[model samples]
Target: MELRQLQYFVKVAKKQHMTQAAEELRVAQSAVSRQIRHLEEELGVRLFVQKGRNLQLTPAGSLFLSRAEHILTDLERAVGEVREFLDPEAGEIRVGFPHSVSVSILPAFISCFKKEHPNVKFRLKQGTYTSLIRDVTEGEIDLAIISPCPETHELVKGEVMLTEELLAVLPPNHALAGCKSIRLEQLKEEPFVMFGEQYSLRPIVMNACLKAGFVPKIEFEGDETDTIRGLVAAGMGVSLLPELALRYSTHIEPCVVKVDPKVTRTVGIIRRRDEKLPPVTELFGRFLMEFQPSADPGRPMDRLDGA
Candidate 1:
């Protein structure tokens, strides 16, 4: 019901031992237990169920724990925002990047941003683009660098960062190895090794194939681009990967074929549409959209979703 109660609940939920939580909070065990009991009675739902000396959350308790953590996190963020509003240059911004973006232009972007905002520390979180969007929308991250905008809710899209193509990475000895360009139709029959359904790339790859008139026969799936490329080189199956996905490899010798000018990816910034822009977040978003010297800008993407 209160901030202090939520803090105690979080500490106890983490330790699953009231005595330990009280020790960590530097309070009497009875005081911690009393507050927890008061919270449970007020909500008319138990937050944790005890089993002898050990502790664990019931199904209801588990769900409540997640909500409690979020409530506490939101409060902390609200306080931090107020404090930062008073002293703009002194707070940390938690930024999340797609796994793909971290390898590409992010290094330069981070270096450049740090030079300008040395007092501002960045806490980096990495995940796929879909997850990044969800985190940013939920106030988990101040800004997210992700692939092209889709029909997402409560997100503000910034300038396009870079346009990229979906390249087919084929093994050196594959039949299409020497080909400079391969159409989506040509790859319709090839076995594909792709990221799982959770990745944004999977939807794009599947849509491309469905447009080409065949369903992709996904033979293997992985979360990492390098792993997928390695699978390709080992003669497992070919993969559709973006430029950012290919940044960390030297071992796999795969021929990357541009899926033509029709199929490309665009990177952009995503922030919560509901939230007022803090100066740091707004500045970082623009800094992210700036062109990098080595960015291999791809062809125009006006017709990317066309069949």
Candidate 2:
């Protein structure tokens, strides 16, 4: 019923322990218990039931917890917005991104943005493609750098910033490692190392292989770009990765070969379509639209010996 009561209830729901929740809230355990009791009486439903020493949310309790959390989050954002509006240049921006872009694209953009607006702060959250998009839609993050950006979504809007090629990465000593370009069909007999199903890249690579007339034999699955590259470098299996991911790092250098069919993914930023962004977030969004990565003549083919 009261803001403090909702806060106490949500914290208790999360911790599932009265003492621990009170400890976290820096309040007396009896005060927490009193607030929880008042909240349940106002709602006319038991929010939590005891199991052993821990508490479990009853059905109604679970529902109310969700609403309470949303309300608290909105209130917090409203307060932050008012503070940010007073001095947009010194505000904070929460941005989400996937690991694939973490190597170069994201750090570069942030570095450049900081040079001009050094007082502005950033809170970065790295997640899978799907999770990043979900965070933006749910208000957990203000903006996200997503790959193979969605064409349309009900809750979010995407803007394509750059389109980069996805190339085949082979072990340095593999038979095809020296080739200028390799066709997808040529790797049909070889085992592949690939990103897990959660990654957007997996489906893109799978469809590309499927179109080339074969289902790749996946030998290993990993979440990190560097891990996949290391697997390929050690002859665990070959993989297809974005060019930017391969270009910026020298660790466990694999033989980078161009995909003959030219697979590529669009890198873009997404934000909630319904919400008017905070002043700092809006400025960053505009910068993203106009920003471009500097050109490097270095191609995957250059990684091969005697090219």
Candidate 3:
């Protein structure tokens, strides 16, 4: 019921011995025992059982233990949230990003942001686009680097960080690889490698194919860009991947071609509107919006990477 009671219960559940729990809590053993008794009495169930000095939890205690731990964790998070609002520069921000972004340009951006705002702390979470959108919409994360925006009900502020055309990856000896220019339709009959369903790229690739006048028959699927590139190198299937994805491919080769140029995705920062973003997040958000992929980062990338 009370927070102290929940904390006491958690410690007791872990230590299992009243004397040890009390010592760890820096309280008298009687106090520890009394608190547990009071909690059990209030809940109308026994929380712990004793037969000699060793302590054990009852069935009821075990169930309560799980719920109690969750409650305490949530309570602590709630406290941190308030602190973040009151003093953002000295508080923490929850940031979510796809693993690819985390590897390519995000880590350096985080390092730069941290150098500028050392007191600001980060709690980084990684997931597919669907999961990242859900976290941002549900208020679990303070900010996120999301791409090819997902369907959402939460209010968001987004800005395009950079835009790069989707390019085709092929084996070194593929016929199309020799062409100075290739159309999406040229590779229509070729087997296509794709990102898994959970990724933001899957829909983008499919829709691009649809617009280009054919539905691709997928040959291989994976979440990793490197793996996708590897598959393309092995002649499994060619893939329509963002320029950033190709940044990881050492074995895989990209054919420089001209296309419609309209097919692209913007990777940017997002936050829920109902909650205020901490100062740390705002600073990071600014940095992300200004960041551009190193190859041709039209804006932020140009500024930061000196391209």
Candidate 4:
């Protein structure tokens, strides 16, 4: 089928109305209808059926839509790669990151990279740890900045940048809040606020508590680090968060104490091992490997300070 036919088919599938699809594509309604009919004929399957005023895809149609969309995305990326090769400084990079680093680490790297390559554009996606890794493996994102970076994955490769400490965060009025360092077992009786199961940090916190000899009693679960911190500050419960996540906490400051055992997570960049990155993505990946934050938040004396 022609490229235009695929384009028209996708547009029609999305709009589900021949007239609206035509309007968006800036083409005659008859032209859109003709193309859809031709596409269906060529594929030897009925793609759409009328549901009152709107059209809906049949099972075959739904399957074809997914493949068609993938083809279109691949074509777009292929074209972008050609243009990027010609002018590496003026291309787009799609990067994924987890919520734990959204406030500090991701911004720091992006700001530093942009200072030298101001014209390079970035599309950043913040997701759960599992989703970020899956996105990289599936080619949804060119790179991902992940914590507790995996050592062995069949589909992706990781480059560990640095290991950062995970500290105990408590409500300011808690008795242990004033201590420099406390054993994990010391807070065993305290109710815990934790990240959801999807986050990589949750298991780390769970395992640390398990190692400390008790299963934590989770009182509240949050998806965002800020939300968990807020819950802790509001006296909801105590939590364990990465040092980077607490670096810029401004509102309702939670007391950040060092865990005596000193739990840490490795921060790293991950990309698909099989795919060759575009010029701009390659450059950014190289920069990340060489870049270091001005101060290591994981240091023992680094207190949680609001920005």
Candidate 5:
């Protein structure tokens, strides 16, 4: 089948509405429908089945959709690489960052990179570590900044950008609030305010607690760090949070204590392992790893290691 047919099918599959897909593609609804039908005929399998007003992908359609999306993404990347090779400085890079990184180095990294490569445009996505890795694996984003580098497929490569200390957060009036440092086991009985299960921090904290010999009693689970910190400040629970999160907060009700064993989260850059990145993306990735935010020069920035 032609590339155009695959493109139309992917759009329709994503939107699940012929008219919506057509509008997104800037083509007529009839044309989209006809091309999708032709694609199905060419594949000798039904790709979509109508369910009320929405178009649903059949089992065969679901399988084909994944392949079609990968093909389209690869084609786009190939074209981008060629264009960027010719003009080196003029290409878009899709970069993803988890909430913690976004609050810390993201602003400085972007501002510094922009001053250096003014023509390079960035499309940024803020997501959880899990979502960032999924997007990178699916080719939806070129690179991501994530914490506690993940176990990835052979196709993914990563390098440590920096490591940040994970501190225990509690209400200012808590018994241990005045302490300079606390061990993981000491907070075993404390009710924890934690990010949702999808966040990479949750697993890190849980594993640390498990090693310390107790499962944490989670009193609240939320999506945002600031919200969770607020809960802690209100005495709802205690939490383990990255030190960078404190830098962005104006609220002073929560007291942060260094962990005795000094828990740390390693933040890193992840990209496709074997694929050559576009010029702008490659340059941006390097810039990010080397960027030392002057505001926190005391924190250690790690060197890049092969994924």
Candidate 6:
């Protein structure tokens, strides 16, 4: 099928309205209909079904839509790589990051980079590690900062930036609050507040607890690291979070305790393995490679007041 046909199909699938899709595509309504029909015929599957006056994607259409979007995104990246090769200093860099890294790492990096390359722009997408990885693989983002990289196919490349230790956070009144360090086994019966299962840190916490001989009793889950810390401070449950995440909890700071086994997560940069990175993305990656966390003592998390 033609690339234009796939583009038309994706727009139609997203809008689910022929006239609206055509208007957005800046084409005549009949052209959108004709292209979609041709795509369906080539694939030997009906892409859309009529329900009253509105259009909806059929099961086959839904599946095709994902592939169509991926193809278009890859095509856009291919064009971007060529354009950036010609104009190395100008272009937008799309980056994905989780909340923990956003609070601690991104602000300083962006500030320093902007001073050197004022024309470079950034489009930031904040999400869990899993979503960030998906976005990188799907070509939605040029690079991502994620922790504890998961096993993947040859389509993704990861370069470790640093391994940061995690600390146990407990309510001020909890028995473990006074301890300098506690073991995973000590939290066996304690109610736990944790990142949502979709995040990479959730699995790391669970596996660490499991290795210590008991499953953690997760009592609450949240998408933001600060919210989870708030729950801990409210005496809802205890949790293990990256030290950087602790900076966001200053308002209702939980007592931070070191973990006995010294749990740590590898924070790193990731990009598509087979794709050629744009000039701006490559430069940012090099900056990340040369970054030294210890050199930046101004990071809020470094205070560790409640530890």
Per-residue lDDT of model 5, residues 15-84, tens digit only: 9999999999999999998998898888899999999999999999999988888898888888889999
lDDT of 6 by residue, 161-191 (tens): 8788889999999998999888878999999
User: Which has the higher TM-score value, candidate number 4 or candidate number 5?
Assistant: 4
The TM-score that candidate 5 achieves is 0.84
Q: Write the per-residue lDDT of candidate 3 for residues 33-57, one digit (tens) a residue.
A: 7777789889999888885877888
- In candidate 1, the residue pairs with backbone N, CA or C atoms under 3 Å apart (3 or more residues apart, or in different chains) clash, namely none
Model 6 TM-score (2 dp): 0.82
Show the colliding residue pairs in model 2. none
Q: How many clashes in each structure?
A: 0, 0, 2, 0, 0, 0
Ranking by lDDT: 2, 4, 5, 6, 1, 3
**Tens digit of per-residue lDDT, candidate 4, span 1-307:** 9999999999999999999999999999999999999999999999999999999999999999999998998998899999999999999999999887787777777876898899999999888778898998777899999988989999999999778889999999999999999999998999999998888999999999999999999999998988999999999999999887787847689999999898988999999987889999999998877755547553312212312
lDDT score at residue 193, model 3, on the 0-100 scale: 86
Stretches of model 6 off by over 4 angstroms after superposition? 1-9, 30-51, 55-71, 295-297, 300-307
Query: Could you tell me the lDDT of residue 186 within candidate 1?
Result: 84
TM-score for each candidate, following the candidate numbering: 0.79, 0.90, 0.74, 0.90, 0.84, 0.82
Question: Superposing all C-alpha atoms, what RMSD in Å does each candidate have to the true structure?
Answer: 5.7, 4.8, 5.1, 4.0, 4.0, 4.7
* lDDT tens digits by residue: candidate 1, 11-94: 998998989999999999999999998998998988788888857777877888889888887778778878778876767777
Per-model C-alpha lDDT, please? Answer: 0.76, 0.89, 0.75, 0.89, 0.85, 0.84
Q: Give the higher-lDDT candidate: 1 or 5.
A: 5
